[model samples]
Target: MDTDLTPLRDRIDAIDRQLLELLNQRARHAQDIGQHKHRAGQPVFRPEREREVIAKVLQANAGPLLSDGVTAIWREIMSACRALEARQQVAFLGPEGTYSEQAARQFFGSSCSFAACTDLDEVFRSQLSGSSAFAVVAIENSTEGAVARTLDLLLAHPVQICGEISLAIHHNLLRRHDGLDGVAAVLAHPQALAQCRQWLDKHLPGVERRAVSSNAEGARLAAHDASLAAIAGEQAASQYALQVAAPRIQDEAQNRTRFIVLGGQPTQPSGHDRTSLILAVPNRAGAVFGMLKPLAAHGVSMSRFESRPARSGAWEYFFYVDIEGHQDDARVARALDALRQSCAFFKNLGSYPIGRE
Candidate 1:
């Protein structure tokens, strides 16, 4: 139990140093690869190559740490190397710190360049206006469902959905002190607060819930006053040096948010992909069902179906659908062709590989 462990500890430390040197060498090779890709006018991210590398690393890993640990470290390395070749620029809704920013960094890596916009519309505009090559915008949350603002933005913007990123949301009740009894006001982004409404109501019943721009902003505001509490992500609490009164305060145990990547052009089909489209149909009996029938007949599975109020029309709505299949596939093309004739207005929103995390 109390035996000497100095030799093993020293060996482990030596191995870690060697691992660091190997990582540095790998990064240098990655820089050369980036230069080659850039000279050839290729995109920095190659999903296929990444998948291959992850698989290889996972298979080769054999130690105290498992595949997950190795994959996690290598993923960050790949992202950093990719950024060095050409700074991968991503736009997101934020004021420097928000869930969108976190999701963007997780998806694009920390080394990539970032643009924080004031609103969801600005995120789309950044991509459309060529200010940023890609945009990351939240689409839905497990408890709150789809973000209405994001859906509306997609309807108005011509940018295409190129990929999807999912982030696990861990909300914490942060304050200047340890307890919630002395807290007078609770602050959080409107959406963040809404997601944890049930918990807040049960715990801090009479407290005033103030809406702020983001979770990080709420944490910053709470840090300034001992009587104020904030509901935010873990990163916010850490960044603002606030005390976490309650950890994992979200209503659902599996709280997660899905973000969509927006860009000017569609991605090439990577075998398994999802395509999104907006359709406006005549207000008639079985119109919605009729529109969906083509997809059903074509054996295409519908991943998401949402309806939003249509502009320039009286009491009309547009249906946004995410379906399984690439646009170039014969089955998808046939379904789109049939659906186009039944719908008044139809727009393809592009297709991309599905993200798993």
Candidate 2:
């Protein structure tokens, strides 16, 4: 029996073409809207509007792709349209192919222009000096805890936390050779090695761990030497043409690093937001509790609280807090006012949309 379905297949192909054409037409309309927004001095990224559009599309799309898939496709389309209107330049700590670079790409899609800085300080300077529109710097790691350098930079710099991205840390053991038995030395950034210490100790027991400036550098070194292995991300393995000897070799499977997007102005609150601030308190008992009491009174949750040694003064510390509301919120405003009365010095580090894992 000849089940001739050629006509139906042709119809399906024609429909696919029509769908693509309709998408292109929509994109053109988006471009026109972008021009109008630019003329009116309006921001290209209207998250609330985007959410509404996505919700409507998902509700209407009842066919081949799921709602989540439809949302994903539309988000990329929206991102492309926004890029055409305003080319956002992002800066991040890297020599390229670092986890920070990955986080930046995750936050701002791959189409966005990026400038990779050598250090966290450079990332801050790039945004503050307007060399880049925004910067991404790692604030905290799951295993290693908070990055003190980032804290210091936040205290010293005038930039605001406009957004945040959470990146999962998956350390891979890469080498030019296929097998791990031939690997004699391991190369990686100090932090990467520290995060995967237990795995390294058990798997490659006596191998020499050489600390480098960046994970990309480590991968490059491993690429150059057949016997050397590098502890880096899966992306680095392909970038440097190294084979993964051990995948996901980090000590913890749930390990994640949070990167903050720093810019000149505060970000518009996205409903789900977090505010960071620095406070210096006198060397006295209950000083910390006094500062936090207002938050409790105002029903604001504290997500993170850490203290760094104050650079200028002796025996005094600067407290860094991440609260669960925007600075513009009345509760947050009252908490800040009360906190000021208790602390010697206080600075709001700008609130932004919270990054979800």
Please, what's the RMSD in Å of model 1?
2.8
lDDT string for model 1 (1-357, tens) is: 324787888888999999889988988999988888779977777754665677778888877787767777777888877776778689988766678889888766788889988778888889999899889999888888888888888888777887888888999999887977888989988888998999999999988999987777788888899889988877777788888899999988899999998873556677778899999888888989998999999989999998888875688998889999888889998999999898888998888877767
Q: Which run of 10 residues does model 2 get worst, by summed lDDT?
A: 43-52
TM-score of each: 0.88, 0.88
- Candidate 2 regions with alpha-carbon error over 4 angstroms: 1-12, 45-72
Model 1 regions lying over 4 Å from their true place: 1-36, 47-52, 59-64
Which residue pairs in candidate 1 have backbone atoms (N, alpha carbon, C) closer than 3 angstroms, thus clashing? none
lDDT of 2 by residue, 67-179 (tens): 65776687677777778778788898777788988888776666678998877788888888888888988888989988888999999877778778788899999988777
